[model samples]
Target: MKKGIDWRYRISNKEAMMGVVLAILNFIWWYAFAYGLGSRPVKDYTYILGFPAWFFYSCILGFIVFTILVWIMVKYFFTEVPFDVDEYKKEETE
Candidate 1:
């Protein structure tokens, strides 16, 4: 018989781990812009084209790059694989 609680169909630990790694990498890249590459807060221009200078110029590039990276991760890493349930299921297939 099935147990009182079945938590299957939930994201596995591996998926969670990969997501955490992806988030960490994204944060690291953002931090690099803030510190490693020395990106300072813009205070001069109000807007470039139609958006704020900081939003249109400084962060726009990072946003594009990060978006691409995240897209790649989602496309390749976050795949739906069958979870191992041999331990939970019985040999009789009950």
Candidate 2:
């Protein structure tokens, strides 16, 4: 019935794409550090803060990094979307 895309749809699509991109980046970060350092022999592994280097970089530090990334994304990239269906309907009928 509508002739063009709605603003809500545009915002939703953008947010969804950003979420997917963040997930992919997080996975890549985890995979690279986990496999790159963990593939070596246990005895040859390095340590950081009493944890294996791979674990430290891939898990502990990753958690911190992604937490900050998510915060920044929400604060800057994400927008506040109204959920008032009645208001939208009223606007459409105007």
Candidate 3:
């Protein structure tokens, strides 16, 4: 007899893909701020809280934004799956 793909695996794959998408978005955010603002000459640079504008946006703000994004993703998109072998066995039998 052949067994079908497990439900837990599907959930895990979906979550993993979501994580990858988040990571890509984070990289894009960092890249945009780091390169878009930082490419200017030092004399033209602006400061925020004594930090360079690029540094403030790319590092500091990026951290806070991604932290919130991850929190929201986990709270809303992620599922609570049982990792216990017994739970799997019971589901398979059912």
lDDT of each: 0.63, 0.92, 0.95
Displacement of residue 91 (Cα, Å) in model 3 is 3.3
Query: Given candidate 1, what's the lDDT at residue 61?
Result: 67
TM-score of model 2 relative to the true fold? 0.89
The candidate that achieves the highest TM-score relative to the unseen native structure: 3
Give lDDT tens digits, candidate 1, residues 1-94.
3565445434466677777887787677666654543445555446657766545534776688768877887788775654557855653367
Models, CA RMSD each? 6.8, 2.1, 2.0
Clash list (residue pairs), candidate 2: none
- For candidate 2, write residues 1-94 as lDDT tens digits: 3666567888989999999999999999999999999999999999999999999999999999999999999999999877698877787789
**Number of the top candidate by lDDT?**
3
| Model 3 C-alpha lDDT per residue in residues 1-94, reported as the tens digit of each score | 2367678898999999999999999999999999999999999999999999999999999999999999999999999999999998987789
Which 10 successive residues of model 2 have the least lDDT summed? 1-10
Pairs of residues at least 3 apart in sequence or in different chains that clash in candidate 1: none
The list of candidate 2 runs beyond 4 A from truth reads: 1-4, 90-94
